[model samples]
Target: MQVSPVDDSLEQTELRGPRARTRKLMLDTAIALMQKGQTPSISDVAEAAQVSRATAYRYFPSQAALVHAVVDAGLGPILEWHSDSNDAEVRVQDLLKTSMPRILEFEATFKAALKLSLEQWAERQAGTFGDEPPFKRGHRVEMLQKAIAPLKHTLTEFQFQRLAKSLSLVYGLELLLVLKDMWGLEFEETQDIAAWTAGALVRTAIAEAGV
Candidate 1:
């Protein structure tokens, strides 16, 4: 029998054994702290997870990396969401309806991520930010574009992008921050308003496009 060379790259990419468990422990600890309204640092997570600071640093070198990982884990479902409906409006509504609860559940963690992003921005503006990796956001852009994909043929490129941009305002952490925090609305009310606004935007776009 002829033997083929084994691919080491796959093994390298997969976290297994103790390393995987340690990384997951840090992530879980960070999530628990963030959910309790605390923006934990790597050291904080290390102490909480009962791992050494050095070990935690090996997994996440900076606070940005830590928060980014935590956010990714928290929003995993939302990030991986897809809709089967062909109607753009239906897709948009389904996304809002499905994602709102999860968004609310991780509201504190997302807010912490947002705070870190703003802090990084301010530091950059003041010329204090060095080579630290920035905590990047904007997942909603792609999600909105995908949700409205069915309308691509009916609308122009500009119309499609504009509708997506408008819908972005009603989704994500900002929506919860505004509707819940500023307006003091409950989760159900916030979701209802978001769904309505998303539906209205889709209808308006289609109407104006004459489709």
Candidate 2:
């Protein structure tokens, strides 16, 4: 006399399996193209992933969304990293050790994504494009704040923010572009230099704070 209920949401998810796979394929294809220093449109991704343009549009809705998805994926471990240690220096070092290699691995891909954001900024400044939503960048500020949380009371609010911002300058994809690309340093050398620079920043900031 009793019957079990079939969940409608579960049923829909079961039916959407292939669609989910296709979406992932398109995203992966987009990242692959970007890794090769190419900025691919959704249509290009669809072609590369063997999906239809209509379906690709259904997944991403716009070029900005598609690129954002790829760039988000490119962030990898750095975006979700957390540290249990309370030592600010140790936390900063661990963050750098975990993130730099991943960033270096996808150097071209991240740079291409950065290039798109920069180009959009320029176009917006020129008043040639104003309707579309802007591409959102990373969460470096929050992460940096967490890394240096122990220094909050030691330093002034402005000093805390300034130190974090300075550390961030040598932390992300810019580290690759600056030390490796601009200075012509080798990979290992670049990592060493970044670590040294970030350590010095932390030391000087703390010293000046009298902590």
Report the Cα lDDT for residue 103, model 2: 85
Q: Per-residue lDDT for 1-211 in model 2, tens only?
A: 1238879998689567987778788989999999999878778888998988999999998878998888778876677888988778888988889888988888898888888888889998898876767776766777788888888888999999999999998788888888898999998998898889888999999888887
Clashing pairs in 2: none
How would you encode candidate 1's per-residue C-alpha lDDT over 52-136 as one tens digit per residue? 9999999999998899889888887888889999999999998898788888889999988888888889999999998988888
Quote the lDDT for 92 in model 1. Answer: 94
Off by over 4 Å in 1: 1-16
Model 2 worst lDDT window (10 residues) = 130-139
lDDT of 2 at 61: 86
Q: Identify the candidate with maximal TM-score.
A: 1
